[model samples]
Target: MKKLTSLLLAFCLTLASFAQQAFEVMTKKPTPGSTIVIEYMPRNTVLQGKKDFEATAYLLEGGLPRAVEVPLKQEGGIFRGSVKTADSTRAVFFAFAKDEIRDNNNDEGYYTALYDKKGEEVPGAHAALASAFGNFGGIWGLKRNQQKGAELNKKEFANTASQKKFATEYASYLSQSKDAADQDALRKLLTERLKNEKISEADLTQTRFFYQNALKDKAMADSVAALLKSRYPAAAQQTELVAQWNKAKTLPEREEVYQKFAAVSSPANELAKNRLEFFDQVIAGMYADSGNYEAAKKYLARIENKQARANALNSIAWKLSGEGINKQPKDAKAGLDFSKQSLALVDEEKKAMKNKPAYLTAKQYQRNLDNTHNMYADTYATLLYHKGDYEQAYAVEKAAVEGFKRKDASMNEAFTALTEKTKGAKAAQAELEKFMEEGKYTPAMKEQLQRLYIANGGTQAQWTSYISNLEEAAYNKFKAELAKQMINVPAPQFALKDLDGKEVSLASLKGKIVVVDFWATWCGPCRASFPGMQTAVNKYKNNPDVAFLFIDTWENDSNRVQKVTDFVAQNKYSFHVLYDDAKSKEGNDFVVVENFKVEGIPTKFVIDRNNNIRFKAVGFDGTADELATELTAMIDMVNAEGGDVKKGF
Candidate 1:
């Protein structure tokens, strides 16, 4: 009996020792298939515990069965778990402390609850009260120590409720602290709540009020706009509502509100000329958005500041470049000069500001200048082709691209790496697998990557191919928009003289099918299509149902008019060819490039009897037979009166 008592006492001593030195785990959240790194403060007082804490990490499955033990380590104040989950989409985990580690009879050590994909909190995770330095009692600071015979109180806990409370408090704390990361979290939460239809207009209004009046911040204005746009679109469109608030009373504030009002108003409100300067910046934005590049250029040019002027020039250059307007040698030169001017202005700004990033107005001018330079190179190369110097042009392009390569090497490398990582074997494969996950890749993105790629000596073939793809995409996008405006639209009014030298208004052809052919003597395509155009005129000569009007533009040669007259007399062309000499009203209108948006020669627009444009053809790439066939088909279609034509394309 004595020997048995001695053995029992020895076991008790071992258990006691284990309880004194053990480490405890308060709580944990382990993401599946990832290393869970728990960062901690620099100081830790839990290194010398008396008992070994039997804290175990478990992956709960099927009604909370026991899980396999994984290794854990405590370094500094942080304790790390070594277990990782793989494809365990529905797994949960928890950790517990042994009873021997308890300091008080009450259960109070540490507990970790986990969740599965649906985020349901796990159950049965509890830690007993302990006196060790690493335990929750030590971390939280003990109010009092329990005596040897203290009575324990019975208690029940809900893991989900506690986690919810903790998460809410933590978020509030983060938001109050103005942490940048909290912004993302808040955005995500609001977005999710809104998406799930868990938020209402009242909720939005209250939040916006708090943000605007209580918080006195504009950060939430965007959120309010988004909410209004989603819930009350009509209200969102009412710009006067913003002014009704009367809270935004600063000059900048009034400017912004007035600009918003201007945006939705057709022809803009009758803003006084003096007041124009108040919203100059906003006016510039409006002009740019409307594709009124000339207006934008004019307004921006009027600004006295060099920085503002340079910025405006850059903006205009960008719009022109995208339209392929810079492809014209003269326009290309203008763009180049504008770019240089922008760069010079930026340089002056830098000198004035001592190389600081302070010029908010023209901050992007440097980048724009670079882009203009590259575009100028492309335009010059194409112009060389017109000058009968293809070889020299190609040489220039090679040199320019090579220089671009040297300047942006590192950026190119990173871009190449990203592309290789992202691109699939083909466009379809890439698009299906990855493209839809992000956004439509834009010109700015392509330009950035390609410029870098060229600088880094990256694969020219790959870069050039990507550039071509981007160009095709942009062209198709713009062409689609243009086509929407052009298909079956009223031909814009054109005022010009007839063969009788009398002003023949386009309104005169309001009741007949009018075919307008824009041509030039020097254009090879125009010369080639002349015979076909003559045939078309003869086909409808005696019909009295349609009219054919030919326009002669770009008359550089001395005998252009005489040659056209002589040809018309000899061949009986039958169509009226108006001389669009320089400074003519027609010539001035053509310079605007807005009437037809024509970029090439031998362009034609077929108008119906009711003064609506029925069809437009560019370059006359088709043969005489095709032209006649198309014209006949159009006349027959219009004559049938299938429907009234739509406007603007």
Candidate 2:
């Protein structure tokens, strides 16, 4: 459970962010303009080249982003890669993300953070790029505790002498030893700074971090803690709660401190309510882990918030009722009771929604209610499956899969339309060949295509042989054959509504280089590639010749736009999102997703100004810097040629 970080449940984030420092990328001499071979080094102890880690170079050449994946190889202790580029490139951007590692989706290896070697202790981001990458996956965003001398913004350094003086001094002091005489000097400096209210927030916080995070000396920590209490008595307890509690490294220590607080904390005390309720969750998990379900149930009943309690119960029930770490019994028979209770509680809570709370909108309440139902349904089905109730389990799974066949409806509609208008498979195969040439082939559509391959029942080997060789020689000839076919196929026309309820159409974006991405909120690699997509959006922010449309497909939400909007807001991402009608008129599943035959998430298509489909890319390398680079190169080539569309290659 992601516990609430209330001044009351007391949550503190320690150990720094794992994703941010996955790789350390540095530029060699003659960095930006020169032909620099981009390299990535695993600085953190957790990384060893045991996994596939990639560093994509997004070099700015010809005023557009060009992405090149530098092939990485492990040689003993080193993980390194390099690439050749033209000298005309202005700047190179690098990002790291992980691929399939250890049987889990590891996409953290591709986040590209920007840093300028500027003479300021600012977060490493270019003005435009920083503005684009919302928080940069914590790779470049500065933490609150890291701000020492007044939490000044990056631009504040330009104010000149005093700001620069303080910045330079702070940087110098960063490496200084907190020895006896040094400690005395530092204490005097901070004491003076604390008197100035302007920087007191940063000063007191700085003092604590310096002693606690850096020095690790208990005497210094105790001395500063006393000083902080004396200076800011009202907020003294609040400050110590996170600072002291976050330092508890052991589970026993954490449990001891939580229990101590629980013992003294009054149940009716408003100040302790958030913390006490949160403590119940923590303690319950601890007890349950030790095979004490009854004790865990007792704490679950103590939760004051009905919805939060129901959600927590549902989470535990789903885990324990399944065959994972939470599995208590072989078939999870022991968890059936918990699951049943959780289902009942969630239903009861839903019926009790008499008044839409002031905190939640009617839409938000409905969404929450629907999510509760979905969670319970899945849990109930899992339990049924485990108990040998195959029929019911299949029924539930079937219903869910039918709804998810939003993909089937979309693909069939587009294919049906193509079949009706073209000369059977001959013409349809030409269109499909474009996707195959770009490696955006759909394996699921093979059966459908094979039936129409030779019209009079073609052999399986024959169908496979026709699309065989991937060599450059064969590909060039295939493109030449494609050139003989339709040269300027209009982007399959589509009219969809964006998140703002405004209609966006392919026809409306005819004069621009339209880039379309088919994705969903649940798709892991899709989200991993969002940062790189955002980079492309930023690149063309001021350009009138290019447009990026993120078509949100495979959405099961009734309020599709709102769901997309809420997700975008929570992530602080900026993208032009449009929803694909899950069930469109004319008996279609989805108009856009089908028209483009986008059966997979994160498939991207580029249409030039002449309305010629210029590029098609399916899946990404879990990078913003990489995607932006590729898009930039394509857009630039199209722009230079004045909309000369090339055959799929």
Candidate 3:
């Protein structure tokens, strides 16, 4: 009776006990250090001495392997060894398995048939090699997030009579066996050949030539021709390429043709109209070269269909805004109009056509709309500056900069979170430090970080750091001068109707100890800390000397007012709930959030009867309980300082 063996799936490692030869990469620590120990079963099968196995490990980067060969020792069906690396970065390891070598001693371990656990014949050395080569190529590409070489895929691997014989013999050996052992061996062999530079150039050229010359199909011919021009232009036969391209008929057939021409020139050149979107790209490129953005807008405006016009206008606007052309004002306004029009067109198309083509076009137009809108923002800021509206200009520029910083921070935080999730805390911290030190942070990084921070309960302190570190000193200087009016100062005074539609004023609460809380219904953490704040509100509500202004700093509208009113009613914890139209006022003017520098939700500020800020706190940081306790103690201290209790309820 055959013994039963259970199979288990382990993410990083697996241990199997079987008659089959098994490879084990043993890590000494619970979490591996830089040095990984490689173990191969049936150690007696390997040759003796430190250098016997002739194994090599690969440190893959950018789809290419940096090989590190390790000396080995055989210890009964298990080969024991270690490969050293510079740092604690986690690595996937592979080692070369070779047959008998031409040793100095001339002693040999004769090649024998390898087998799987089921006792089936493994393919011969050469055959095993070809398959391994293919596997290695695929894995290398995969690690780099790229595709394997197109030339390699199309070309014949073995062409010279000698090499052909070897491949044929190997293929024959592979065919004779059906076991996974044979397949594995073949895969391993091919991987070795891929690393050998000698094999690369020879195999690549032979394969490329075979695919180009032997495969007479127009599509294949054209692809090969284009690939050759791009990859090996000096060796390419332009005449043959031209002939193949001319014969193309179908769309896939035209892929090779387009690539061929694209290799010679840009996609915007004449005779290249593959994608409809490329039309706007071409027009933009042309207009950009001539430095006539107004002319470009004129061209864009001529498009009869709104979608097309939107696309053209969007492209032109993006180019002008990015390049900071002097004539962008006219182009930007037109682009803004076009984007709005395109949005309308997409809505109309969704309702009327509802076809895939129209929908896709609409989507493209919509993307252009967003791109143009982004450009419009920058252009509008510039226009404001030219118009001597320094404050408005600064506001827009600061918003743009903050947007970039937030995006960067969000990306950084994401990478940090992912690393922590996958590799544990130490590795994650190391990755984080690497990012910060290496200047990997970008505008996108800022945006991503801000989004992530918002998601994971961020604070004003984090935002402050984010703003300061947005760019280099010059950029920092420019940003700092602008932020002087916005940062950590007395906020501009503004008033609006409360949830009851009654007039509310900052001046009205002047004489009392005012704790103005700027909040929104959509803010998650804000809602969370409300109960704690309500406790504070209840403690002082009856005291006419104290005023708790629960101001909702969002747009003043019926929907907003209703949401706040409903929240207040459900909770039955009402202070003075008010609304703020942020659209009309800069963030620096909001009493609860902006004036008090409240970064995250549920921010609270304690104002003395003299209307001076006595205490301020940011996030609830699992410290909401602590904050409440502290606030109570502080209130007692304030009362001891002769703070009057005007009215007791």
Candidate 4:
């Protein structure tokens, strides 16, 4: 009886141990060139209650990390997946995700080391895992620890040869180190290796970039470049040819440079091939600019990549159609020709695509094709509308709107206009009303609808009441969707100097609703988002409890402050621009962005009165009014909420 009780207890303990783990590795003692099977039970973690999950295995082989997505299959309550490793794989790290929510095993991640023939762990397995965790972990939703990663790198790459072999990774490690002495030691080691070792051209190029960009040592970088040029003259000449081509102003000069470049550039070089294609597009644009549509078409024909060719044609067409540029009848005619050509190219490409790429599923591929076709169709239709051919424009635009189900605001506005011309104002008004109710209509669409309503003998009071009802319904719908995306996280404390050198800190605005925007002068998307941000700022400027901080970060120019000031002045923006000049423990600039764990620029955070981040917006893809409306909704929600919200991770 005693033996039986002990056996039962042991069995229960074993089962409990298995249940405690979020994931289990089915493959025992995984080695190089082997398959690893894993079972994930998402009873806990962020992926809890989620039906679909994907496992991404990060395999480090030959000093490079490769991410392989393993499709998970549901088996009872758990998900099962497997991945194959290469013979040179040192380690395999796993991260699980269901859409945006990720399970990174509490940010430590789940991983296994590959073993050698004798069943011992590989020498640099931990080093590979460390690099994967620190460098590329954020891409898979795992938090990065640069200091810890640097320690592991220093421990593994003790010898100069190993450091030279993995020069890029080694340099990244050194840059992360806080200790100046450690950097000096590694720099000396690499200097000695450069003198003694017969390094490859690739390594030399990486080393040169590290010295120039990372270390800010122009002299050392120039010396390395000289060595690379002397060792590989063809590569050096190709680089020079590209530089000359960029500088060339006249068509004949550019043609001469292109001939020289083509002679030295190898077909096997992907970068060179891409550059050649880009040159062809630029030459085509130049011809289009000079109003030589025939010559432009001939130049565009030289581009081998069909998608690139189509995009080039669309860009030229857009430029000529007087969308943003000055309008001319001749330009509009040429634009119509280019737009037709672009749409035809899209159709041909769709017919030729027999199979989707391995990365995208069949549904995703079809959706992509539909989107591309619709976009080109809209361009064609828009050009026709500019040409005053309303009947033909309506025919092309209908395929994009009705056939492909395109819900874009601009596209729908154009469709409504065409509808008014073809199907009468009543039909257009009904269509606009449906779109407004669905919360898919833009401010421009709203104005057009109002004009039609007034022209159709509707009273001003009736129009106002009708629009107000639609807006309220739309706002409620938008709020419900935004509620699902609401999250509560502690806002990282920061103090930055405003443009006038006054210090503004988050602590100072404790009871106020704060909107923090991270931006830079050089980022195109960041600049594009500012107009909407300004709208939001202007809306809340009168509110004493609201504050907007436009923090400038990640600027590489020496005169970044002056440039930022000049930009604001020229744009006539009334923004409270702040400088993100704080340094990390490693002495790296732009600490605020790092502390916030922001992956990209134009990210905004809405902090509640309690100093908790209630909302985080990553990018702007809509109109200025849309952004303002979204921001207002977030602020109102945060303001209305009571009690301390629990942190969401």
Candidate 5:
């Protein structure tokens, strides 16, 4: 019994030792500006812990610090890596990352434990939490920490952590602190570091950090800007000028800032005058939005350049002829005056721009001037109808549509058709451009987007590549919103066969909300959406008031029906299937494609009980749960609405 007890005690000690095993780090700045070796030991999760881990050596190369990954090997008990420091290196910082380590108890995701110069963990709020740092205790392990193992004594580690190689603590504080005085002190500390420092690109960026954070503390920002100007005069001036422009309340203050900016950036302040004229154009819009047409016109009159004045007037007139600011009713008569004035200026300016220097007279300026004239003409026609002058309105509106169509055939054919439909100009010039300022994409713009998509084989990457990062996200969001505005149009009726060879019509599916999914047998993304769609289907499956039609369109096979049947059976998908055989082999002239303009496959349409297409989605965004939620929302929307005949997408 005593022998067993002794063995049990030994086992308990071993277990206790294993439980305490955690990461350790030790650093030595061996030979100045030569090499710094870092030794680490991490906790073992399985019978064998991680084989190796990555140590990111934040070493200074030519006074600029950059992170370079150094792979460490485990031998005996510790992980070690010796990396060469760059020339003129002053300090070093180290961190463990992308390690193949896992905890059996928790997988809180990737948490970085930052360490200072002394090899002590510089703990953050996340590190203090038991949920995150439970595994990161200390360097001791089941193996007695030996050579190649970190020789960093606890006393040395504790003392050196206060002074770091990097300005991480200062950077963190500068970003987070709201107190102006505290921020000022930190900036002063950082500035002292910059005095003798030969500035790198990173250092230059950090030096300009004050202006980046200037939106919060304008007074401190001004002080910092003053300091920055002493060092970087041009950059500081430009930054301060923009700040002043954004902050200016009165028009004169804005003009003053604009003049100063223009003087420095453009010789002889030519850009300033043009910018001021543009400013007047924008301010006029603000007045119109406030329902003060007279005030808006007064602002427009401030624009000195004839073309700029006309551009402003054209914008104001468009607002007056249609739904005014915030979709409020417009004043057609008031709009007509501005429209007439703008058209006259447009013609005059066209001749004037030709004589001006090429730089001043850009191609875009000409296009904008011409587009403004076209838009103003619509406003003029709209005003005539409002005053009961239908004959003149019709003649003017028809002429405008024909003029643009002659130049660009793809310039929204719907708008041209709508224009021609006006019985003498009973005022229905509700073109696509009237709503969107820049969103009113012309033929060239639309063709550019289309050709890019076609080149990429109908993938979203092409669309993303065409726009900037910020614009890509915003444009996609805008496009998604546009797709949702279905105009309550009637769902185009179609007769198609099901898997069992029974024919079905949209007419037959009356008194139910029908979900029409245009998919193909081979479309991978379409197939990926099925699981999530199935979850939604299961929810509404028992509800007799809802029906789903999984239309197999744009199928690669000549025998699409057979392929669809095989796929659906193989997956055991409980979906209401329909076959839409393409009239041609290229799959260009299918009924769904031809009638509803389904250019891309995996298009979805939600129809209400009244047979109106209420919602449409063009692609299968990869998220089953999100798709289910959207489907549920669409189903609920139609279900909640009382059965009434509404406007028809």
Candidate 6:
């Protein structure tokens, strides 16, 4: 007995040591409804040397997965946190991040299966894990693996309750799978379920989607749809309403469609309320386009959700202000009114504080509210400034700057311009100089500052030196930050057709440094980032070792190539645009983007000579010079490495 006890103790110690290497779970056999303590050791992971860390627990509860931010406390060299699993918790996937740096266990993610009293994996646990690997993983910043997810999902299909519960996810997996056998199996399963009348409404709905979208079998999909309409008329009507709304081109047609839909859909239905709000916003925009401010305001007033209404009003206000002040100058009054309404709505929301979404933490919710308020206030101030209300604009912009802590560049620029109007050129010059030294000024702000400097008797040489010093300082700071985010991941290889139909392959550019940017024509951030991208491309045009390739993905138009061509030509951007037109056997596209595991557009990857992805940048912050500097620094860093390191994945 002593010998047996000694062996078990040794085994347990080994297990504990292994677990402590990266993450340690205190509860060895964590069951549903129990709280589990997790200790994260970031000694050698991507989050190494980060002082603060955040933990997001992706929990599967009641057949639905939700992300909950779990607070962590630093204990010596590790961070510790605990999460309470609900009785229905099937699995939990943990993701750790410090701002943009994430440690998703190198994309495999850190997760564990929940158990029952009998120590067996709970029902739907595999399905939840599958979702963590496939569908929900990308949304949570974890790499998606559809094949692995589908394999896991296959285990739960035998359980009828689980099948019904996860019908949508299962159908999604079936649609994404490129295997002919998998497709055939899904069709067979659907036929069997339909013949036996064993499928639920959810299952039937997903089945129709699979046939229509994935298999492209319109006749079969229509047959299933008709059956669904006969069985679940309410769900069918909701779907048809959306289809009709999408088909409607004119405002009157949309209004008629909404009236028909409203007559059938109940006010109690959340979907109905969302559709009504959407229709109201669309109609309001149409009226505004036609210069009918009264009709627009009437439609906007019908929107029930305060935040949504405020957002719609702010969007319209910003659009009108941009057009009227810069181009037309006649819609300024209408924009000001809309801006006031938006500000009032935002103020009311701040007072109420009862519309916080469930997904955000209290702190996050407050931060979002503050951001929204500041954004609307900036718009209001801008409109006021454009309308020649200098004093009021200064006051509103001052409050916004204070609220933003002087971090927002555009707001600071607006405030500086207002300061010139309200105070004097000297006061504006002083403010601009402070913002420039703090690296909180935009390119437009810099131009304004230079104008002020030249007007204030400062020499061109002095201004040039001042700008150069600031640029050098900013470049150094950005380089240091980029150095910390450096990684050595293997770049996925591809041979794509460029705009000229000439094939370009990663293997062909073996000795050159490559910058691959994933974007779509519809992405605002992507379009906004192009100026900076153009700057970087121009800077490297003479460098034979550097190459930039912009791959357009996720576009659904039939004339996608022509649209992309026209956009690039119209913008005068000299970019070698590649079309990501590879499709799956199921006819689903965005294949290269999927392979790269990119969750969003405007994601750029810097590859070294050996094709290792040294850095990945996501999103654009609307700073052209900063983006150019950052990309230049990344390329220089990779070039300095000389491609000597071993390849990694």
lDDT tens string, model 6, 1-649?
9567546743543353235578877666689999978889899988899876778887876444666788898878878888998898888878888756888876657777787888866887877888767666775587766666766676655467766766665666667777897688677767766785756777788788888877778889999999999987877888888899999999889988878888878888886788889999999988888888888889888899988899989888887777322234446788888988888888887777788654455555676788888889888888887788889989998998988888777888888888988999899988887777666777777887888888989899999998788767766665676676688988889999999999999989989999999998989999999999999999999999999999999887777889999999999999999988657434246778888878788999998899879888888975787788778889988988733333333
Candidate 2 least-lDDT 10 residues: 9-18
TM-score of 1: 0.26
Candidate lDDT (C-alpha), each: 0.47, 0.54, 0.45, 0.78, 0.56, 0.80
The positional error of residue 436 in candidate 1, measured at the CA in angstroms, is: 43
Expressed as tens digits, the lDDT of each residue in 15-49 for candidate 3 is 22111344555543312225666665533333343
Error of 6 at 460 (Å): 0.8
Off by over 4 Å in 3: 1-492, 555-558, 584-592, 595-597, 623-625, 639-649
Give me the runs in candidate 5 sitting further than 4 Å from their true place.
1-241, 244-267, 291-295, 324-328, 352-369, 406-649
Enumerate residue pairs that collide in model 6: 324-329
Per-prediction TM-score to the true structure, in the order listed: 0.26, 0.34, 0.24, 0.79, 0.30, 0.83
Using lDDT as the measure, the top candidate is 6
For residue 181, give model 2's deviation from the true position in Å: 32
Candidate numbers, best lDDT first, in rank order: 6, 4, 5, 2, 1, 3
* Cα lDDT of model 2 by residue, 4-51, tens digit: 322221111111111233333333323333444434446543244446
Q: How far is candidate 5 from the true structure (C-alpha RMSD, Å)?
A: 25.1
Which candidate has the highest TM-score of all?
6
| Model 6, C-alpha of 555: deviation from truth (Å) | 4.2
Candidate 4 per-residue C-alpha lDDT over 412-456 given as tens digits, one digit per residue, 9 for 90 to 100: 877888899889999999999988976777777898899999998
* Candidate 2 local lDDT, residue 276: 64
C-alpha RMSD by candidate, in order: 28.1, 25.6, 29.3, 6.8, 25.1, 5.4
- For each of the candidates, give the backbone clash count: 23, 12, 37, 0, 2, 1
Cα deviation in Å at residue 88, candidate 4? Answer: 5.6
